[model samples]
Target chain A: MSDAEIAVRDLTIRYGQHVALKGASFEVRPHEIFGIIGPANSGKTSFLKVLNRMDTFTAGMHFEGQVEVGGRDVRAWRNLYALRRQIGVVFPLPVGLPLSVYDNVAFAPRLAGVRAKADLNVIVEGCLRRAALWDEVKDRLNALGSLLSGGQQQRLTIARALSQKPRILLLDEFSIAVDPVTTMRIEAVLSELKAEMTIVLVTNLVQQARRLADRTAFFLMGECVTVAPTEQFFLRDADLDPRARDYVEGRFG
Target chain B: MSAPPPHPDTAALDRRDLAWYVDKLVAVLVFVGGVSAVVFIVGIFAFVTHEGWGFVSEHFSLRGFFGSIRWAPTSTSNPTYGALALIAGTASVTGLAMLVAVPFSLGAAIYIAEFATGRTREVLKVLVEMLAAIPSVVWGFIGLSVMNPLIIDVFNVPIGLCVLNSGLILGLMAAPIMTTIAEDALKAVPDTYREAAEALGATRWQVTRRVVLPAARQGLLAAVLLGVGRGFGETMAVLMASGHAINLPTSPFDSVRALTATIAAELGETAVGSTHYQALFALGIFLFVVTFVINLSADLIVRGIRKT
Candidate 1:
């Protein structure tokens, strides 16, 4: 009944005796910028890792969940690679690959069998431009990516992710270490990218979630207290639940 | 303000202060040790270059140095002392060792460092360290006992001490160095790189081939350099396995002598003030320079990776 691009039902994650997420459920709307806001150690990373099937929870520490992206159960998909190709990710830290600037962006497409030089050039340039990194690094495509500044490195990482031409982009604190100006630049880029890709942001900063998210999910103690449109979630949280009221009133995290 | 907290705090500080002073002293000692290592290496290069310049630069010395195949520097009739025999031996042994050792050692290293975990990784590290600790003389004794007979009789390769035997010894000797260095390089790679590759749905082998190895390129080069240097500089194992022949080895089955062995073999009996003695010294120069160049190349490669 919901027009959700991604639907999570009966989601639960446990790390040994510690429960990370209790029976969590949420719907991510298509092409919407969805923000996940939680304090440190609140299972944001664990949840994101599960979504990508990157979590290696011990056998006993099971995740009881169903995650469907584009109406296909993510776990049941016959080809995980095909699913991944449609959803790009930028990690919390800038994972600048040990490759030349151009190759970092060229890697995925090449792996996916886009071997034509002309197509590669177009893809790399377009992604870099979308990442707002083209003008600075256009002349140094052959240089090692590690030589770039922290901000530039993050942009390059974003460019690399974009090269996958994903329908969904997952960002985990993409601007955490960069300068404020660069953070704003990335936020602007995400604003534009949302028209083409469903953007999911995991952040600790409330102001950031309010600025960029169309809908926001507030998590506390491994539970989603509520998730609603950004304006309603922030303005109408006082009467929703005690935890939500305290969190919204700034009395607690 | 501090006086108010003088109950238990002052005594705690007094205890910690002593530990802090000792820690500072330990840090100073470590700093001095690091600098001394640098000074020691630099001094050796400077001293060797200063002493061996005449031989290194001399046209006659260098020509007779690398171009000939002579080992009887003490032979009264004709003291032949050309480095060709030694260079040929070193090159053959090192090349063979690399061919056999590089792929196997790197594969094992990648398996242990990137793939293995828990008790398996710990066991691998312990095994590698133990192998490295096994003394050179023990390796020489191994070649003399277990390896020597196998080559001549069981293996039935002609010239029991030949390029093949020497190569096998060098390969085994270089294994620990290769695995340890290569594993270190692989470990130095950030875990995030692997995670990113995996998140992109790359299989284990594909991730290793495409992401891990390329990221660990500088370290892998260093690892290879360390392996080659160990094999080239190794004297006793090669001496025991090689037939000490001065001629060119035509194949793996043929006998050959390397430079390190020649130096070891000739240095003891060369009479003082004889041309044979000087020529042996010249061989020492060649061995020293070659090892230095290998180590230098490793340093340059690591630097090149950093600059980019």
Candidate 2:
């Protein structure tokens, strides 16, 4: 079998005495859409944060077990910059930095030592195009990113994530601040993005998972209850654990 | 559920009775107290300008006031009141103070806000507050007794009382305020900016330089402006540490006198209504205008930053 793009084994996360995730393990295949659906505080965001080591910003966060990307152990990597550069994350809210729209998308590339103005222009335009935000902001590239509409800001953030040229993209409720039309546009963008990199999508909207995700995981409390292909989970006699079936059916969360 | 019993005495009192009148009376008194502060500031401005009216009416020459280098106001023959020397002195001392204070306080602010954690940050904050609480007279004494000897020995100068000496003391006085205000500004930047920057592979230093500082630019600018205002108006420390010479400072080591120091040193000796006294009041007017312009420009810049 081909190696998993991301492999996790008994990943446990804690904030002081509070356990955020309890020995959860999963794998995501390359070029596939992996959806994580859970109620609030079920560790979906925490799990995404751990992928790019963004959780280090939180005080008193403790982690156990292993997370490997492309067969390399994440913890063993000494250069966090190089590791994080390979993975991108989009947050729930659209937090456009207080910078020009063009500069916002060009930020990552500039950080990675891309100094040529021509190269930056290409990267910024290309990323904006892939995020489906190019037409709306093409004329206002010099305008402040904070001035963009909420939906446009969300797309700008996605464009910024793409600018990193990440191998894996983790999105946490990216459509929460996005309208349905923008959401549909982004869903199309995601379908295109999966051809280039693996996508880990954590969503509150279960229907988003049904439409996009090739594989789905259900989380409850702090435990990942099940991981199955999307079609099998939707089947009536799908051999899923009864609780997973009830959750998928909207009987109880 | 049963209704709770009401107090008979409370029930008899109307909402708009004596208690309400007392509340309104207290509110008006507090409002008047707040307004009194503005009144006092305006009153001082008016009194100074009124006393200095003679200089404005008769002796005011833009060239004589600002063009000449000498500041021999008490000369028996000519009584030259040229402020060019004094202005140069004030600029050099205050500029030196800013040069020393800005980098030090900004670094301290960033360290306290972003790098220091928990017990360290709390202890540093308390220490900074204590530094701010130290009286200007105490700082002046320290500069005179301790810093003077050290500067004399190190630089091998004939005298330690110079623009550099006054500047260093003023810088110390401004450091605590600048650091405190700048730290508050840096801390006010949302955690989300840091998180987003970090997720994009930014190191902590990079995030601080690129994201945090730019986000807090307006507040940081205000912090620098307030520091300048504090240094510009400082008197006791400059009066003690500076040599009180009315000469253009050629170098950081040259003896000089600031406007505030001039006012502090000579105001007591000048008679009530002499041209010298009026000139001093005129100096007060200049100081007020300079500080007002600085603060107003800073406000404009902050507003401009917000509009972007």
- Top of the candidates by TM-score: 2
Report the lDDT of model 2 for residue A201. Answer: 97
Report lDDT (Cα) of residue B121, candidate 1.
Answer: 86
The DockQ-based CAPRI class assigned to model 2 is: medium
Please provide, for model 1 over B35-129, each residue's C-alpha lDDT reduced to its tens digit, 9 standing for 90 to 100: 99899988876765555455445534555766677666656687666778778888998899898889879988998987787789899899988
Local accuracy of candidate 2 as per-residue lDDT tens digits, B1-308? 98988777785665688888999999999999999989998998899899988987878789988887777779999887788888888888889899999998999999999888879999999999899999999988888898888889999998898898989999989999999989988998889888888899999899899999998988899889988988888889988888888788888778888888888888899999999999988889999888878877777866776665
Model 2 / residue B143 / CA error / Å: 1.6
Worst 10 residues of 2 chain A by lDDT: A48-57
Displacement of residue A214 (Cα, Å) in model 1 is 3.5
lDDT of 2: 0.89
Per-model chain A TM: 0.93, 0.98
Q: Give one digit per residue, the lDDT tens place, for model 1 in A44-81.
A: 77778667666641234557888788887778877777
Candidate 1: residue pairs that collide: none
lDDT of 1 at A194: 90
lDDT of candidate 2 over A186-220, digit per residue (tens): 99999999999999999988889999999999988
